[model samples]
Every structure is written in structure tokens, then in C-alpha cells.
Target: MKDLACQQFQDTVAEFLIRHQSILDIISKSQESNARVNRAVVKAVTHCGCVKVRAEKSAIPPEATLADLKQLLDSHLDGELCPNCREIIESEMGKSIFYLTALCHSLGLSLADVLQREHEKVSTLRVFNFT
Candidate 1:
């Protein structure tokens, strides 16, 4: 019903990105610190119902195994990999932005347009804003 303003839209998207970046920073730090990596991965798998009630379940695929993923993260950290964890973090964060951008593009909506609409919606809400 209303045309989205560019400044408001960009600010809203920037805020969203900043919040996601903060969460990612915590995860990345945990990975680098080697704290709870195995436990977190295991918990995620179990929560997804991937594990069996019996003693053993199906083996994790080589590529998808937590071990492999951690190795990848570690290699990325060591500078042996072209992009350190920082690059990986950026790429992962970029993914959501890229996906939203693609969807907007396909729907004939500019990011500036949708973002401004979302901003207005957030601002209009009295109790809470970030969403």
C-alpha cells in the first residue's frame, strides 16, 4: 500500500545483519576455542532425531560429519586455508542476505522496498521491535 523509503530499508537490513553477525561471532569463537564443539554437534544431531535408540545409528557422511566440518573450520583458521574462519563467517552470513536478495529480485521487489516496509512494521509495533 505504501512505497518503501530507501534509507529506512537499508537501516533495517543493516540492523538485522548486525544481530546475526553477533550470534555468528559467538559460534566462531567457540569453534576456535575448541569448546563444546562435539557436544553441540551431537546435541543438534540427536535433536533432529538422527540418532538411533539402539547402540548405534547410521554413520555420518564423510563430508557432513562434525569432525570434517570442524577440520574445515580449523583449516580455515590456520591460514592454510585461503579464507580463515572470518571469511567462512562472512560467507555464511552473506548466504541469508543473498537468499533474501534473490527472492526479492525474483518477486520484482527491490531490497530497499521490502526492507523499508519491514522497518515500518517494526517501528509501528509498540511492545517489541527487532524481528
Candidate 2:
């Protein structure tokens, strides 16, 4: 619940910027076209500061945990992104969702349970606030 609480805070700021006329128009067009443009923009270019893979053969390293991600990123960044910065994005994207599952091992809640609880909070807040 605490982790979910913080993610909501980060999402609020992102939603605010994306609510602009030009931003919303771009999002709407991508949705209408059923294009990967929206996802590429949001996931990589917007937040992660990378682009979607342009070639098929080059592989991103397998990221199953924060440590795994750190290794993969370290190999690329060479200390460019500080540890704190890396943690923030990974937590936001829940990029290593598999890591979340591992972290939740033996816990009763499923991913669906976690998502529903988090979504419920967002749904209740029509206007985003960092409460």
C-alpha cells in the first residue's frame, strides 16, 4: 500500500503535463491508430529517456529484479544514472513486474489484487492530488 501510494504521486505530475491540448491530441491519435507510438513515447522516450528498439536483433538484457535491472543498466549507463534515480523509475514503471511478483512471494495478494486496489484509489480521485 505504501509503494502504491507513492506511485500515485508520481503519476499525478505526469498526468498533469499530458492533460495539455497538444499532449492529449497526440495520445488520442495514437490510440485511434492502434499504434505503438503512444507506448514508445510513454515508456521509453518520455520517462526512461531511451527510444524503442529500432532493430530487431539487438536484445535488451533480461530484467527480473531491481538488481538485475541495475546490472543491465550499469552495463549501458556506466554510472551515468545515479542509484536513486534508477530506483525511482523502476518503481514507477514497476518495470520489473516479475520482480514485484518475487518480492510478493508467499503473500496472499495476486498482481490483479495489487492493481485493483491501486486503480480504485486513482478512480476515486477524479482530480489528481498527491495526498
Candidate 3:
């Protein structure tokens, strides 16, 4: 159960960050009494970028495959993120997931509930597509 929570938290953070690419440079901290988790997430996302860095959202174009999305990025970024950023993002993401998993253990809050709330916030933002 704990392991699943960790994975879910990681996935949720990735999705939210991917959907909100403009804030990639910002380090979002928790406003709750405990901020360690949020700080971890901010660090992780910074290091790895998103699994799927959708530059902008449109309904998935009819012919697009996940590979295409990744391939596009590979061709574009040259070789994913630089080494330093990758390390930072991975470490931060791992820390954040661990904290969130701990929250699930202590507070009985489902990862989905927290992730959903975060996604709701992203859904409301205005995203501009340039292509």
C-alpha cells in the first residue's frame, strides 16, 4: 500500500508539472505546517522535468502516440535534461513522494484526493498554445 502511494504521488506530481510547464522554474512549498513534502516535489520536478512535457494541451492529436511525444522532446531537447538538473529533479521527486506516502500512512488521506485537488488548480489556469 505504501509503495503504491509513493508511485501515485510521483505520477500526480509529474502530471501536474507537465500540465503546468510555465512554472518549471518555481519551487512550490507547502503552506501547511509542514512544508518538507512540497519542497521535495519542487526539487524533484525541477531535476527531471515531466515524464511527458506537453508544451501545451490540445486534445491529444488524433495520430499521436506517447512515443511521438517523447520522440519530439528527444529531438528537441537534444538529450533530455542536463546531468545536474536530472539529479536534482530525481532527488527532489523521491523526497516528496516519500513524504506524501508518509502522510497517507498517518492521516489516511488517499493520494488521489491530494493529487485531484492539485489537478483542479491546474485545470483552472489559462494555458496559451503557440503552435
Candidate 4:
């Protein structure tokens, strides 16, 4: 079901992305979309004041294990995105996904397969994946 949705989205993007058919265009647009997504998050934090980031160094004990690090670390994000900010963020994220899917289409890759492989890797590796 998820794969079907991904394929449908990819097909839609391939159909509509007439102007950016070149690989270079697709790559550049993908980067631009990612930047837009980042900008939206920054706007939410800086302009909206709905969310605050209190990032700081994590103070881990000398005796702490790898699993204990998860409990000690924090995202440092405070509060939730207000409706307006949330909408903007979601729209920007959608554009990112669209361009990502377009890239996959241009490369003859399946976004669903890529997501599934990553999911399996993380599930199997668990906390050790990053390390």
C-alpha cells in the first residue's frame, strides 16, 4: 500500500515535471526544495516564536552505556509548531518530497525501495546504526 502511494507520487511528478527534465535541473531543484524546508523551520523558530531550540551539550556520565546515551540526550526543542507555521513547514516538506521523488524517477530508482531499505537497516542496527 505504501509502495503504491510512492509509485503514484513518482508517476505524478514525472508527468508534471516537464520543465525540469534535465538531471541537472532535477538535482538543483531538489537542493532548493531542501533549503526551503530548512528555511521554513528556521522561520518557525525565529519569527513565529512558537518553538524554541535550547540546544546544549549533553552531559553523559563516565559510566553511561550506549543505551543510556539515548535517555541523556535531548532534542532541545520546546513547544509545538503553531497551525500557521505547521502548515508552511508541511508544504515545504511536501515540495522536498516531490523533488526527491523526481530525482528517483530520473535515476530509475524506487523511492519506496529506498525507504524500505533504510527502514530495514535502522531496524536491524537499532541504536548502533549511527555509531
Candidate 5:
């Protein structure tokens, strides 16, 4: 079911991406869309004041293990996205995904397959994946 949705999205992107047919265009647009996503999140925190970031260095004890790091670390986010901010962020994220799918289509890659492989890798590796 999830794979179907991903394939559908990829197909839709390939169909609609008439203007940005060039690989350069797809890559640049993908970057722009990603920047928009980051901008939307910043707006939610700064302009909307719906959320606040209280980020600081993690104080990991010398004896802490990899599993314990999960409990020790913090996202540092306070509150939540307001409805308006949430909508904007979702829209921006959709654009990001569209461009990402378009990039995959241009490269003759399957987004669903890529996602599945990554999922399997992360699932198998668990916390050690990052390290």
C-alpha cells in the first residue's frame, strides 16, 4: 500500500515535470524545494511563534551507551506547530517530495524501491546505522 502510493507519486511527478526536463533543472528545483521546507519550519518557529527551539549541546555522561543516548538527547522543540503553520509546512514538504520523486524519475530510479532498500537497511542496522 505504501509502495503503491510512492509509485503513484513518482508517476505523477514524471508526468507533470514538463518544464524541468533537464537533469540540472531537476537537481536545482529539488534543492530549492528543500530550502523552502527549511524556511517553512523556521517561519513556524520564528514568525509564527507556535514553536520554539531551545537547542543546546547534549550532556552525555562518559559512561553512557549508544542505547542510552536516545534517552539523553533532546529535540529541544517546545510547543507544536499551529494549524496555519502546519499547513504551510505540509505544503512545502509536498513540494520537496515532488522534486525528490522527479529526480528519481529522471535518473531512472524507483522511489519506492529506494525507500524499501533504505528501510531494510535501517531496520537491520538499527541504532548502529548512524555510527
Candidate 6:
């Protein structure tokens, strides 16, 4: 959906994806294509899905522009206008990155070492349901 909406920048995104494909492919391969995640996590990942279905006045892939992505990524919470939400989200992201790094280290793998094994599959929790 995000990709389709970014069609105007199709070429740019395609090139970026190509440069980043190795990491993307590995992370994708690490997770089972069909598996149930924690119910709460599922809810978060599917938030856009819900919004899409319900016709809410929230952001969709198409509504999102390059500037919005940049704002979300910039380190300054001041840019967000809502500092508390921005801080909370960034904090959660930090914890998630730490969790991924530690888990990867314990498994003798780099963060990019995420690859699915046909014989066994494990859960990867990207977010904690703190909110």
C-alpha cells in the first residue's frame, strides 16, 4: 500500500529498495509468512488496515508525503508539534532497537541475520504494548 501510494516516487523508492534489499530480504525471510503474532501487536500492525476499511480521517499511504516521513524520522521532537506523543514514540523505538540488537547478539547473528529456517520458526516482537 505504501509503495503503491508512493507511485509518484516509484523510481526513487525502487532504487532505495534495491540498495536496501539485502537487509529487507533477510528480515522478511526471518519471519514466518503465516503466523499469529501477539494479538495486541497484530492490532498495531493492522491499524492502517482498520483505518483503510473504516474510512477514518487518518493518514493512509497515499496521504503520507515524503515530508511526513522525514518529520517522523527527524530526531527533534519539537518538529512533531505534539512533544509528548513524539517522545513516547521515540522512546519505544529506542527500546525496540535495543531488544533487536541484544537478541541478534545472543543468537550470534547481526541484526540483518534474520532469516527463517524451514524447520523452526520463532516470534519477533517489534513493539511492547506499553500504551
Q: How well does candidate 3 match the true structure in TM-score terms?
A: 0.33
Tens digits of per-residue lDDT, candidate 3, 1-131, equal 65476566656655555322333222232223136444444443555554323344444566886655644443222235556656655766665554444444345566666766767666765232212
lDDT of each: 0.46, 0.45, 0.49, 0.94, 0.94, 0.38
Alpha-carbon RMSD of each model: 17.7, 15.0, 12.7, 0.8, 0.8, 18.2
- Pairing residues by index, what is the TM-score of model 6? 0.28
Question: On residues 19-114, what C-alpha lDDT tens digit does candidate 4 reach at each position?
Answer: 999999999998999999999999999999999999988899999999998899988999999999999999999999998999999999999999
**Candidate 5 per-residue lDDT over residues 18-65, each given as its tens digit:** 999999998999899999999999999989999999999989999999
Q: Name the TM-score of candidate 5.
A: 0.97
Ranking by lDDT: 4, 5, 3, 1, 2, 6
Candidate 4, pairs of clashing residues: none
Pairwise lDDT winner, candidates 2 and 6: 2
On TM-score, the stronger of 2 and 3 is 3
Better of 1 and 6 by lDDT: 1
What residue runs in model 6 are displaced by over 4 Å at the alpha carbon? 1-81, 112-131
Q: In angstroms, give how far residue 34 of model 5 lies from its true place.
A: 0.6
Indicate the residue-level lDDT of 65 in model 2: 49
Better of 1 and 2 by lDDT: 1
